[model samples]
Target: MTPQTQPAPAPSPTQATAGTRRGRRPSLGAVALYPATFLALLVVAWFAVTTTGLVQPYIIPSPVDTWKAFTDNPEYLWGHTLVTTGETLAGFVIAAVVGVLVAVLMVYSPTLEKTFYPLILFAQVIPKIAIAPLFVVWLGFGASPKVLVAVLMAFFPVVISGISGLRSVDPELLELTSTMGASRIKTFWKVRFPAALPELLSGLKVAATLAVTGAVVGEFVGANSGLGFVILQANGNIDTAMLFAALIIMSALGVLLFAIIQVAETLLIPWHASRRNRG
Candidate 1:
């Protein structure tokens, strides 16, 4: 009689997902096409509306005028953009470091989590604009206030996502690590942190965009420089083209930060399900 053949073991969920992604992975150009098409359509509509006088040029400046505005004073705008970018980066770094630390502490200590979670929620709910003045008052009319506001705006998501990720580790895996005589720190570094990374990165992407907004809001409260200041000045002078240009630059800054975070996520968590799906 012929020897009976044994069936192969089924692939795990992660492996299966990775296999699917490998099969369906799209080219970079294919991935970019949809957004590029949409942008082209939007530009076309913008040109049509402006040229046809459907919207007053004063209210929404023509694309050509906006481009001219940016080109006319590129240096001035670039300087202010650099200032805002600095504030945003500073605040994001602080928020990310502090948020991760707070998350770790809360995870390790149930009492701390119970005590501070409500306060954190309350702080998040209060409008940043209302509190921006307080920061300006306390920190004065410099970059400090802007950075502080950015930290506040970007902190919540990091903490929430961190908590969710830290808690998501499998109990069985943790038990195995413990049985193998791994220290708590080792277990956390090797297993918990990696497991938590996907959620943490998601939160970080959101925080990155919010940091830009926070910096701008801080500028709105009382800043002499930054894109926000440029926007304010353009508004006051009724320079609609300059205002549109400033707004466009501000949006681009946020998108840039978001894209950087997304690249980081892709590099850091290539094995995560979300990344696999995107692949």
Candidate 2:
């Protein structure tokens, strides 16, 4: 008998598409390299501008001075950073729970949607800055106010995206699920919720970053602690370097939280188009 050879499996759609673009598209490392190089150049320009006295030190502190600010007083900055992080995490968690619950209620009940959806939109339009003080008054000058402010800032996006996601389920699929004798709760959990994960996660990622801003805003308005307070104090004292350091820390915190959400999205829904595209 003649020896037989097994044929190779056909490439998948993703593989074929990737192959087609391999020559045209920049490699992942190249894409990353460009950003890294750009950032390095930016830092070099910043250092040059400050060191060469192109900008006044009081106006734009040198990067070395900014580094010194953190090194000289690590305890002060680190403590405030931890406090801000805690408030942000607390507010984000609360917003996620409330937003998802509200989305589910609106999706399931037309009455609730008709009555409450407009109200929710109205609430979003009301400036959180105008209301941040009220929370401080009602909840006292504590973490409560900061957390509430963060919640207000982050809540709407999650609710809106979640509602869209849940409602995006194909009506035909829902009908089929009903015909198959699945209960409403079962259908939602098994089909609708999963279908909505991508949009919901996108909203959460936005909310996560907003939560940081909200926390800082609350601290700016009232709190005596946190990076926001540090910035405020630095401004009053003309400590531009310290102010820059605080700002840098806040930006890093937001980036860290957003990155965490991205990781969670990948882990939770590896099959999502966004995750697959990244791959």
Candidate 1 residue-wise lDDT, 55-126, digit = tens: 999998889999999899999999999999999999999999999999999999999999999999998999
TM-score of 2: 0.89
- The whole-model lDDT of each prediction reads 0.93, 0.90
Candidate 2 lDDT by residue in tens digits, 1-279: 855577766778787666442245456587579879998998999999999999999999998999999999999999999999999999999999999999999988999999999999998999888888888889887898999999988999999999999988889999899789988889989999999999999999999999999999888889889888999999999999999999999999998999899779867876677666653
The TM-score of candidate 1 is 0.92
lDDT value for model 2: 0.90
Q: Which structure among the candidates has the greatest lDDT?
A: 1
The alpha-carbon RMSD values of the candidates against the true structure, listed in the order shown, are 2.9, 5.1
Model 2 C-alpha RMSD vs. true structure (Å) is: 5.1
Clashing pairs in 2: none
